[model samples]
Each structure stands twice: as structure tokens, then as C-alpha cells.
Target: MRGMKSRLLTRREMDDLITKPDLPSLIADLENTPYREYIIGAKGRLDGILCIEAALRDNFTNTFRKVQDFVRQEEAERYIVIFLHRWDVQNIKTILRGKNIHVTSEEIASCLVPAGEMDEATLNELLKQPDVRAVVDLLATWKIPYARPLTRAYPEFLKTKDLAVLECALDRYYYDDALASVNSPGYNNQIIQDILRLEVDVINIKTVLRMVRDRVDPEEARRYLIGGGRVFDERKLGSMLCLSSIEDVVKTLANTPYRFLADLPESSIRSQKISIIEKELERFLIRKGVGAFRLEPLSVASVIGYFWAKYNEVTNIRVISRCKTADVSPDILKEELVYV
Candidate 1:
């Protein structure tokens, strides 16, 4: 962890990258940073967003490699793998989406990030399947746990042709698996569990808000409600599902530990500009992770916090580069970013 901390980019470095005038400038700046080798490799082979994505993927691969290589504690390595599984879930979801749309294998391969358990070759093989169902079947054939939720969601996906059902099932399975993995009785593991629980809360809150906004039936909306949040158990989420409006949901949330959510503008939520709420939630999570890092410098919390910080930095740069390419004003892009 001590060695990993020094490798992480400082706030100033992130600021410098964020303020780059254009995508090419950003790529140029990356050449002088830890991503220099990836930048060099991507030169001429890729450009613009593709280049950035490739560099980020390579950077992610190296980040985990460095952590696992440096950390002597077997426990720390286990937690890191658990943390990285989210990307595995993401890669699978991307493949599923591509399969749903009948995209070519190359097109599907371009979107994958081999930052998790499944390597690039495995994901590419999954892409070669004839359809999304075959992809889901492949997971079962491989004895992967993700196949269960995906299989359960497949019939509904076929009936409704709504990918959200499948996506939600994936989310539920991922969080459930994450929470179970970290549920062992201990203080450091408890910290990781809390961070994950907060994540589950944010997902549940957003799901409920979107459902209310879309006028989804309460019973139908509850299907997306995930358990394991600190503030929201099955019963509490059920109660929330009974709320008539986003305003009511906000009021209900104000009585809970996540009262910070009340700070979000009800009008913005009603207007469907929920990005503000999402950003605030991310800021809240980042702040909590940082706090845990300070309180437990030698513990897994430090790695978790540094990971979130780096994750946010990467996300900010990606958003800035993409927005700059689209000629979005710097002020608007900065405003959308969470800087904890």
C-alpha cells in the first residue's frame, strides 16, 4: 500500500490532465505520466477516445498488477480481487449489450476492459457466440456464478425486449456477491462492506427515483431494489416503493442516514436531470473512502480509498476529453465532475 500510494497521481497531476485543451493534448500529456508506455503503444494504432480507452485499460491492468505484486498480505490481495470483480461484471454487461444489438465481434471486442478475472482472450471468445443467449449459456458452461442471474433474467428479457431487466439482474448479482465476499467478521472487512453498502444504496436510490419518474408500477420497480445497503433493507426499500413521488422519496430518505440526499434539488430530479444527485452521491462516497483511509492508514481502507480516488480521476479525465472533443464548455464539464 505504501508503494502503491506513491504511484497514484497527485491532485495537481489530475488537474493538469483535466485542463488539457483537447483530446490530443490530453494524450500528449499522458505520454509523460505513468501511462507513458501505454501512450507509446497506442500511438498511430489508435487515436482520440479509442486511444484514451486503450491507455486507461492498460493503466488499469498495471495498477492491479502492481498492487498484487507489491502486497505481501494474502488478505489484501483477496480484497483487491473482490474489488476488481465489478469490472468483470461490467465487461460481461458490455458483451451482453453488444450481443443484444447484434454487433460484430470486433465492435464488441473494442468496448471490453480486461481489468478483471476474465482476460481479453476469454471475453473475445464470449463475443464469438451467436447471440446473447449463447453468451449467457457460455457462462453456465464455464460454471460462472453470473450465469444464474442472467439465466433468470433471460426469459423476461425475451418477453419484454428490455435490456434493463437483464442489466438489473446483473447488478443485483454483482452487489450480492460483493457483499457476501466481504461479510466476514472483522473491522477492515467491515469498512469495505460499508463502502459497498453505500454503493448498493446509491443504486437502489437511483433505481427507485428513475422508476418513480417513469411511472413504473411499484411492484415492477421493486424488482430492481437490491438488499444490503446500510440504510435500506428489504422492508425499508419496500416502504420506499410505496412512495408516490420523488419528493416523497426524498422526504423518506431525509429520515435515514443518507439525509445528504435531501440536499439534491427536487426540481432537478423531477426534470430528470438526476446527474446532480448522482454526482453528489459519488462525492459522498469519495469523502467516506478518504475518511476511512485517514483513520486506517495501514489497513485495506487505504487501498480502497486510493482506488476510488484514482477511479474518479480517470473518470474525470475521460469525461473532460470526450466533452472537449464535442466542444463542450470547460465550465460545464468541471461542474459535472466530483472532486473529493
Candidate 2:
């Protein structure tokens, strides 16, 4: 709202722009290898950033199609726009990481979303540049000022394997910015706030759990806890830590919205099996997001719903692909799958 001069699509406007005719046409266009073409469109337009359209066309063909029917997409587009923002940032995140660690340019290139910010030339150039600092510099030309945060934070992010710090910074910055104007006239979108709260909360909880398991000090663990997720607020997290066993953990969380995971009586939890809990909770979030999208189809709710689904699709495909590439057993891969 502060810096972006471009118009954001209103619910009514989104309804008009994305129609039945538009959906199938967009979907049809996505059939082949348009990823490169998307890269082409997104690259030089770094300032205006058409990556959102690219992402919607590339990754969200089904969602775009469903919405284009004009009956279902208004809600989908709410997030359809923002998800483009988020996933684009995420792609830049991974690419930056790969570049920092000196992962191959080709290898890094293969993982791009082509819909977010990076264009092929700039991304290629950034990848070819020496390190993370160069990547930050390459993105310096961006009109949306938030890219500066990553540029500034690279040193600390390098010192700590705390990629989440950068990610969390981006996350908090994004929602804080997106939700800042929610109370303004003609813009009463609370669903974005609510769902984002849950997501951040889940991430904070997972981070705290990982830190504890990784043997980071309690003080450090406390430091790592993000202050405000729907589930893991400071108070909730304090109570959660007092529980000794995973059963106690499950039961303590049983009363909260997250209690859904505990409803599965047979799902056992060993400390080492915490990833299982993480997976189940994540799937629960996706399912919940989908339901929310259906309920509030034309608002920010639908956008988030489609966003979550698209993310799951991309992540699932990546997981399956990586497993296939690694020649892992189906049994093991199944264990790692989120089943969303």
C-alpha cells in the first residue's frame, strides 16, 4: 500500500477480469513448456513484476481454470495474486541459498518458479555471480523495497544456519505489509490475517521443536520462538514446553484448533517422529485452507486456499521428484509424504 503504485484487484474487479473464457484459455496456454516464456516475460519487467501472472498461468492452471468458470475464481484470485508474491519470494529464497552454498547454476536454475521475481537472465547472472551478496545486489533494482531486507540480513543468515530467520523476516514483513491496510475503507479482509496467523504459529512451533531437538539452548530456543502465531503464542508455547512427553504435548495441544491431529488415537508420537506430527499438521492446514477457500470463495480466503493447494502441489512434486531422482524406496518416500 505504501510503495506499490499498481492497482490491486478488488473482489469485484477480480470477478470481472478472471472469467470462464479466461480460465480455460490460461490453462490451455500452460500445457507445454511455458516456464521459459514466463521467465522471459518476468525477467526484464523486474520493476513492474508480472511474475504473479506467470505463476498463476504456470502452476495454478487448475485453480485458474476453476475460477475462470466465473462462478468459483473470485475467491481464488485473492490469493492467486498474493501466492504469486509468496512463492516468487520462496523461489528467490531457495535460489539464493543454492547460490550461497555454490550449488550449480544449472541445478539452481532447474528449481525456479519463473512466476515470481527473477527473470532468466538476471537469475542466471545472479547465480553466476560469486555469492549471496551478489544475489542481493542483483535484486537491488526491485521497486518493491522489501528485497533490501534479504540484502541486509545475508551476513547473519550465513552465520547461523538459521535460514528461517531470513524466511521469518520475509514472512512477517509480507503479512504485516499485506494486512496493514485491512482496516482501511473498502478493504475489510480479516481471513488473510487469521490464516496467516495459523501458518506463522505452526512454523514457530515447528522451529522451536527443531531447535530443542537440535539441542540449541533453552534461551536460544526461546529466542527462536516467533511472538505471534495462532497456535503458538508466547503463553501457549510456555504451557506447551512444560509438558514432558509427546503424549502430554499432544494432549496439551488437544484443546486448541490443532487438536485435530490428536483426534487420531492411533498416531503414535516418538520424539524422533516429530516430523510425522509436522507433516500431519501441515496436511491439516491444507485441508483447512481448502475448506476456508470454499466458504469465502471470492475474498482473500479463496486466494489463500488456492495458494496452499498450489504450494502443496509444488512441494509434493518436488519431494516425489527428489525421491525418484535419489532412487529411494517407495516405502520410505510414503513415510515422508504429507498425503495432502
Q: Write the per-residue lDDT of candidate 1 for residues 156-267, one digit (tens) a residue.
A: 9999998889889998888888888878898778888888888888888888878876778888888888888888888878778777777777788777777887877668
Model 2 shows how many backbone clashes? 7
Best by lDDT: 1
Clashing pairs in 1: none
Runs with alpha carbons beyond 4 Å of true place in candidate 1: none
1-340, model 2: which lDDT tens digit per residue? 1111122223342222223133333233333332445435544453111333444345444434344355344443454445456656767777767866779877776566555444456556666767766666666764455576676666778789666667666666666655563434432256766676777778766765565456565555565465546656677776565545566667677778877767654555654467777887788777776556455444555555555655554454345445544566656655665443
Against the true structure, candidate 1 reaches a TM-score of 0.93
Candidate 2's C-alpha runs over 4 A off are 1-78, 141-144, 158-162, 181-188, 238-248, 263-268, 298-300, 314-340
**Alpha carbon RMSD to native, model 1:** 2.0
User: How well does model 1 score by local distance difference test?
Assistant: 0.81
